[model samples]
Target: MKKKLISMLMIAAMAVSVAACGKSTPSETPSETPSETPSETPAEAKDPSEMTIYFLTKILGNQYWAVVEQGAKDAAKELGIKNLVVTGLASEAEVEKQVQQLQDAVAAQADAIVLGPVDSTAMANPVNDAHASGIPIVIVDTMINTENYDAALMTNNVQAGKDAAKEMIRLLEEKGVKKEEVAEVAIQIGSSGSQTIIDRLKGFYEYWDANAPQTWTVLRDDVKVNDGDISKAVGFTQDFLTAYPNLKGVFGPNNGSTVGFVTGLKEANRTDLVMVGFDFSTEIETMIREGKFNVSTVVQKQYLMGYEGVKQAVELAQGKKPATKLIDTGVLIVDLKNIDNDDVQSIIKPGK
Candidate 1:
């Protein structure tokens, strides 16, 4: 009976040991029951909004700049850019005012700046500051001297000037003014410091040197500086009429000078003098239509300059480079002959 009892106790102990061995260890709580559906990757992030752009022109309230402003506005609306501040001084001579505007843009943390600099050299430091602050710059209409900018969109002034020279020669020839009979030709510039004007002058001289008759004189004194003032331009034009009685042709490379030239020529009844100028205005268009002075002018794609400048500025803001750093917007030579053509009309009336 004692042996049977001890065997029974051993059997019970073995059963307890077996039960303990069968119990499972805690296996990390089974790692959150792996979902049947695969985990999704997050979508790529989007570009931020509320991009503020500054379209700073050399001057405000001018017909040429008004068209440019319209182009910028059109682009801003198309791109969904919320803040596009188009601002500038009343005159291009206000270099300090432009510098202040640039500095203000920097202080306001503008995303990008599209500028038609008043003075290429004076605006360099402010542009440098804007660049240092990570704001991109797109120069338009007029060029700034620095390569630190993202893009430059402008009419090739040199080529435009050459075209003007050719037009002048053609008109002069039509007037029975032979190359040998060409007494003098003159140029009225808006500003001596303007790079655009300087380039135009260089182009005119280059063409003149290559093609103009040796007897045709370009008097150094006849190249007058009008300081971009229409009144000043008028004065200069009148002076040219008096100073060179045999003046055969004249080129005005800016709107102010061109307008002044037209006014002075009409006032002096010197409509026989061949004139080739830059830009177009109501007055200029009327002059061309009226057959005054056989005038032909180079019309820059101001609207394209503005449109492309904003486009490039926005692109740079969004971490993209323009297809080209320098975008030549192009120029058109308009006269009465082709003024009514669809293409010419488009250039003349850019807003249309």
Candidate 2:
């Protein structure tokens, strides 16, 4: 990354602390972490000032969706739209629960729906159902494998993974770590089937295959799929590190798992182990500030996903076609140098 771009990333990370969580408003603060929690009612009394928008993510316990929800809540407050219950299954592996949440939202007569489908095909039925009911659905964070939805607001996951890979390579080069000597680098994926997770792995491996072919190789078996639980994330990471004595680094495709990986690394006192993970969580931010991890690939504008997701949904509900099928929210690489700096803290502060 260029110095200016790095500087900008740092700025966004810091800015996010205050705005990352739904601290600014209630709607975006997830009822559950990545777990999708749909309100039984899905709306208030339908106050004229507040339009209800229902939302669902991959899991409820993962902090990653918190940022996305924060984005949605921020938008609701700004637009006087009531963001319905923002919830999802506890992991990406649960497609049934995810679909149920969408159906619940639609049944409740939500004015609009924002869904982060666990499975592209599984979501088709519920998504189409919602659409047929005159409810507009918008996707954020992860992608639905099919282009069945009206629009997808997502992080540039490929670039996110590539950014992390670049940082890992940079750190390795800085430490005089030879590429060919790497025996094992564990891949901690959120979900193998999810397009977003696949993209992250693809981005990292693609970069290595093209530029560092001889330098790196993935210990695919060492990977842990938390499906998106923090506890599971921590446990998987601990087990991977324990079993793999020669492990050099850990890569996670999702925020909860990556942050959990860092926690496990911290507990193991393996400060030397490199971590190039995804999502911009407060835990990751602290580690980035302390230089505990090598680097973190962050989707800085999480709040925008919720805010803009609602904005997009509202417009679409009014019969306006969103300008794009996949809105590519940018990604960033955050590290120690400017983690606590005013500009850097803006977008990545924990629990903000």
Best lDDT among the predictions, by candidate number = 1
Candidate 1, pairs of clashing residues: none
Could you give candidate 2's per-residue lDDT for residues 1-352 as a string of tens digits?
A: 6999999999999889858664655456666443344322324223424567787866665576777777777777777774457776766778887777787887788777888778766676677767777777788877775555787887787877787777777766665667668546777766666777778778887886677647466786556677666788888888887887777777777777787888888888887777777767767777777765566555456766777898887776655677687899776666776556555556665335
lDDT of 2: 0.72
Query: Candidate 2 regions off by >4 Å?
Result: 1-50, 213-215, 341-343, 349-352
Per-model TM values vs. the true structure = 0.85, 0.79
Candidate 1, residues 201-318, lDDT tens digits: the string is 8888888788878888777665887767788888888888887878888888888889999888888888778888899888789889997568888999898888878888877876
Cα lDDT, model 1, residue 217 = 72
Q: Candidate 1: minimum summed lDDT over ten consecutive residues — where?
A: 37-46
What candidate 1 gets wrong by more than 4 Å, as runs, is: 1-49
Q: Count the backbone clashes (under 3 Å) in each candidate.
A: 0, 32
Q: In candidate 2, what residue range of length 10 has the lowest lDDT sum?
A: 39-48
Candidate 2 positional error at 332, Å:
1.0
Per-model C-alpha lDDT, please? Answer: 0.82, 0.72
Using TM-score, give the best candidate's number: 1
